[model samples]
Target: MMSDVFLRIENLRKEFGATPVVNGLDLDIKQGEFVSLLGASGCGKTTTLQMIAGFEKPTSGRIWLNGKDITDVPPSKREIGIVFQNYALFPHMTVEENILFGLVLRKVDKAAQRKRLSELLDLVHLVGLEARYPRELSGGQQQRVAIARALAIKPNVLLLDEPFSNLDARLRADMQNEVKRLQIETGITTILVTHDQAEAMALSDRLAIMHKGVALQVDTPQATYDHPASRYVGNFLGNINILQADLRDVGSHVSFSANGKSLQVLNDQRLSPERCCISIRPERVRIQPQPTDCEVLLGATVTSKNYNGNSWDIGTETELGSVNINIPHHGAPTPDRGQSIVVGWNLNDMRLVHVD
Candidate 1:
C-alpha cells in the first residue's frame, strides 16, 4: 500500500567527533510539499540533508521513505535525487552528456534515454543547448542542467543544497522562481537547505528553522516570522528589537513596564510577573513626534537611517536600548540624527518571551 507520508525522519541524530551536528531531529514531509531546512553554517541543516540522502550515516534514528525504513541504505541504492550548490557538472561534457550521464550509468535503454533527455531539456528551458559545454553556458544555465540531471532519474524525493548560492543576485531570484515553478509542475517532494530567510520564505510551503543542531520552529513562513517560539528564532528570521521588561500588577489585563514606560498585554497565558523579553519586529514600530496614550511609548534619539527603495530602515537609540524600525518610503517621517522621537507600538504587536 502507498504510504500517506512521503518521507519521515524519526529522531535523526549525527555527530562529528565531540560536536553533535544533528541532535534528535524529526521531520515529516508529505508528498509534493516543498520544505526548506533553513539555518546558519554548522547548524546541521546540510548534515540532516546528507543523512537523508544516505551520504552520511546517522549516529542514530530511523529514516522512512514511503513507509519503508531506509536509514541503513547506501547513497547509490537510495533512489533519491540531489543537486548541490556547486552545480557539479562535468566541464568536459556537453549539457546533453551531463544530463544523460546518470541514465547511461544505470544502463537505461538508448531510446528511453533520448526521450528523457529531450523532455528534461524542454522542462529546464534549454531545449537546444544540448551541444553547449558547461563552460559555454551561464551560471544559471549550468545550474538548470544540474537540476535537470538530478531529475532525470525520476527520484521520489529531490534534495537541493544551497542550489542557487553560486548564482548572481538577479540570477538567484530568477532561479528561485524557476525552481518553484518546476517543483509545482513536476510535483516533486523537495527539501531545500538554505540559510537565506527570504529564499525560504519565497519557496517553502513550510520551513524548518534550525539553530545549533536543533529545530527551533517548523511552520509556514508567515507563522514562523510572526510567532517565533524563542528569542533565537525571533532574531534569526528578521530584524527584531528585544526589550527587557518587568510585568506590572494590573487589575484585569497584564502590563509590562520597561524603562519607565508601561505596555499592556493582550495575552495573559505567556505573561509572567518575573522579568521577560519582549520582541517587536521593526515593521511593527511606529515613530511619532509625540507619545500616544494607548500605545507603548518610549523616547528615542535617531541614530541612523537607510533608504532601500521601497522601505526606510530607521535606527533609534532609546533609553532601553538601540532599536531598528522599518517604515514605508512613500510617506515616512524623516527623523534627523540626534533628534528625539517617540517610538510606539500596540499591545497586540508585542510578544512576551521567556528570558533565556
Candidate 2:
C-alpha cells in the first residue's frame, strides 16, 4: 500500500512588509511523519508554521492538506492543532476545562466531551491533575496540558512551535522523549519548528535546515550530521574542524596538502582540484602521543581539556589550525596540556566541500 502525502506545500512564500521571510519554499510531508523546520532566528521557520496554522497568510503559493486546498482557511476552520512554547493555557481555567474548551465551543455533548477529556488527560499523563489550574502545575506539566488541549479537537495535523523551549535542560530532554512516544501512539502528521538542532534531531523523522528563509538541506538527522550538503550546513549541524587546502593539480586520487602533511582522498569524486574545504567531526579525529605509519599526520599542542562527564573535549593548537576533539572517557588517561600529539583521520572520514 502506498502511504499518501498528508501535507503538501508548494512555492510557499511569506513576506513581512518589504522583506520576504519564506521565499519560494516547497515541501511534502508524509502521513504520520514528524518533520521539523530548524534554523536560527530570522530564518522564517516560525513564519512557515504560522502560515500552515492560518495565523499568517502567505504572500504566494499553495498549502494542501489531504488533497484539500486550505490556503484561504481561517485558523478555527483549518482543523490543525497548535502548541506554542509558552503552553498558552488560560491562567484561570483548570486543566480539564482547558482540554474541554474546544469541544465545548464546538457544542459537543456533555457525555462525549467528558469521555474525550478523560482520554486526552490520560494520553498526556495528566489524568489525576484535571482539576488543577495552570498555576498549580510545573512548566512541563503545563506544557502537557497545552498539548492535551490541542489534541482535544482530534486534529489531523499537529503544529508545535518551540514546544519545549521553556523547560530546563533535563526536563526538555524528558519531554522530547515524551513527544516522540505520543507521536508514535497517535500517528498524526506533526510539524515542529525549532531553533535547537538537538531537539530537531531528537524528534524529526526528517528535518529541513533553513537558512535566510530557504531550506539548505532536508534529510534525516543522522544524514544531515554525517553528510552535510554544504560547508554552511556542516558547520551549523555540529562541531566540525575545517581545514583550508589546495586541491589544484590533484588527480583521481586527490590529496590535501596542509601543515606540511598530505591526506589522500579515498572518495575522489567528492573532491575537486581547486580551493576546497575539508570538514571532519571531532569524534572522527584520533589523537596519539606519537605518529604512526599512516600516510597523513599533523602535530598539535594540547591547549585545554574539558571534562563533560561522559566525554572530554580536548582543544589543540595544530600547525593547520586550532581544532577541537571529543574523546570518550572509559578510564583512559587524560592527556595533559602542553603535550605535543599527532592527530590522524582516515580519508573516508573527511568531507571535501567546495569553497566559494
Candidate 3:
C-alpha cells in the first residue's frame, strides 16, 4: 500500500562552475513507491541520484525523508542502499565478507550477523556460493551479490543506478525480474535512474521523465505513455506521429484538421492555440482495406511493411499526413506494400500534446 508522503524533494538545484545541472526540481515519493528518474544522457538524472545519495551537495534546496531533512546528512548515516551500474563489488573479498562489511562496521553481534548473512544469501539465491570471490561469479551473479550486499543492512530506501546496463538482453530481463521481486518482498521504497525507456517502464511504479535537469512529466508508466504532457515526452516515450493541424472550436468539442481531413474530439480545455499539432501513436491507428461507413481517420497507401514478430510496422503516406501504423498479427491478414488502406482510431486516443 503506497500511502503518505515518505520522501519529498523541495526546490532542488545544483550547479558546477556556473553551469546548472539540476534546477528547481520538486518531487514527492510515497512510502513503498518505486520511482524512476528517466532521461537522456546529460539530462542530470545521475546528478540527481547523487544528490539524493548524499554524495553531491545541492547548490540550493532541501531533501526530506521519513519526516526529517537529510540534505546535509552524511552518506554513512543516511541508511540508503545503492546498487551501482557497474555492480561495484570488492575484488578480493568473498561474497559473504562483502555482504558482511556493513554489519561488521556497525558491530552487530556475531549470531545476528550470521543469521542476516544466511537470510541474504537465501534471498538473492546465492546460498551455496557465499564463499566465492567476485571474479569467480558471472555478471548476473555479481549483480545478485551486489544486491545482497546493499540489502544486508535493511535500508530505509534503495537506489538503483542503471543496474542492468552491463547485462545481456536475457540476463537483463532476468535481473529486472529479480529486482522487482526483491523490492516487493523487502518493501523498501525504491528509486531508479536510467536512460532506457523500456527499463524505466518495466521497473517503476511511476517514472519522472527529466530533461535538462527538470522533470517534464511524472506519472504512471502507462498513463504517461498514453497522455504525454508534451510532444517531446510523447516522442521520447515511444514512436508518435506528429501531424500538423489547425484547431477549430466546435461548442464543447474541438475539430482538428490536417490537409482538409478532420476529426473531432472532446476538448480537453488545456489546448488553446489556434494552430497546433496532433500526436497519434502507431498502435492507435487500425489499418484495414475497408473501414465501415462511420468514419475513417485517414486514407493512405502502404509504402513499406515489416513483420516484427507480434506486429507489422507499416509505413504509409496518408492524405492526412505520413504516419506509421503498428498492426498486431493476431490472425489479421497482412497488408502488402502499395496496398490502399484506411486507418481508423477512437477519438479518445488522440491526446492533445503541447509543443515544446
Candidate 4:
C-alpha cells in the first residue's frame, strides 16, 4: 500500500507571532490508514490537525489529498469530516436535524438524505433517539450524534480532535470501540489528534510522536513502544528503565557493562557500539528467588513493593543498578522488602536508546 499515498504533508510549517508550532513536518498517509498525531499539550498536535483540516494556514508547506494539492483549499470544499473534542452539536437541534444539516447544505436529494440518515443512526446505534435534542442525550449519545453528523456527507478523510476527552472513563472506552468500528466499516482515511497515549495506541494503525513542533518518530503502536527512537518517546509511551553502561564490541556482538554486571546485546550495525545507554521495559524484567537461565541475571534486594490490581511493582537495588520489575499478581507470593531476589531478562529486551 506504499504506492497508494492518499494524504501527504510536505514540509508543513506554522508560526504564530514568530513562535513556530509545527516545523518542517512531512508525513505520508496511505489510503484507509488510521494515523494518530500524539503528544503532550502545546506539542502542536492540534495545530497540525487544524492545518490538515484547512482551518489554519501553514506558514510554509504543501498538503496533498488524493493526488491533488489542497493547501489552499477551503474547508467546505476539502470534503474532510471533523469531530471536535467537545462534540459541537447544535443545542436546539434534534439528533436527526444535526445529522441532516450537512446533507441539506450539500443539497442531497430528499430520498437519498432519508436513506443516509437512517443508516447513520443505525451505524451509531442511535435508532430511537433521533427526535431527542442534544440536552436530552447522555455524553456518549451526544458523541455518537457528532460522529454521525460528520460522516453524513461521506468525506474522503476524517479528523478527530480528542473525541473522547469529555466522556467518563467507561464511556470513553465505549466510544473508542465505536470509533474504531466506524473506521473499519467506512474505510475512511482517519487522523486522530490526542494527548492520551492509551487512546492513541488503541485507535491508530500508525502513531506519530510529536515533541517541540516536530514528529520524533512515526511507526505502528507496538513498534513505537518496543523500539522507541528516543528516550523521550520511550518514557512517554510507557514505563522504561534506562541503564548507563560502557559498550564493548565483541566481533559480531556487543556487551554493555555497569558496576561489574554485563549484558550481551545483538550487534546492530546501524548503531555505533560506543553508545552508553540502553533501555528495557519494566514488565520485560522477571523476578525469581533463584537464578534462572537468562541472558542477564543479577542478585538484588527488594527495596519496596507496591501491589497494583494485576501486577506487583517491585523496586530493587542490585549490582547492575537500581532496577524495577513488574510481576503478575496471580496468587504468587510477592517478595518482601529487604528480601534477596534475582532479576533476569533477555538481551533482546534491552534496546539502545538516545541518552537525551
The global C-alpha lDDT for each of the candidates, from Candidate 1 onward, is 0.87, 0.86, 0.87, 0.89
lDDT of 2: 0.86
What is the TM-score (0 to 1) of candidate 3? 0.94
For model 2, how does the per-residue alpha-carbon lDDT over 100-124 read when each residue is reduced to its tens digit? 9999999999999999998888899
TM-score of each: 0.93, 0.93, 0.94, 0.95
Model 4 backbone overlap count:
0
lDDT of 4: 0.89
| Per-prediction tally of clashes | 0, 0, 0, 0
User: Looking at model 2, how many pairs of residues clash?
Assistant: 0
Candidate 4 lDDT score at position 353: 69
Residue 281 displacement (Å), model 1: 0.4
Question: Given candidate 2, what's the lDDT at residue 155?
Answer: 96
Error of 3 at 150 (Å): 0.9
Ten-residue region with minimum lDDT total, candidate 1: 266-275
Tens digit of per-residue lDDT, candidate 4, span 206-294: 99999988899999999999888888999899878877566777766678774366657765544666543677899999888554766
For candidate 1, list the clashing residue pairs, or say none: none
lDDT of 3: 0.87
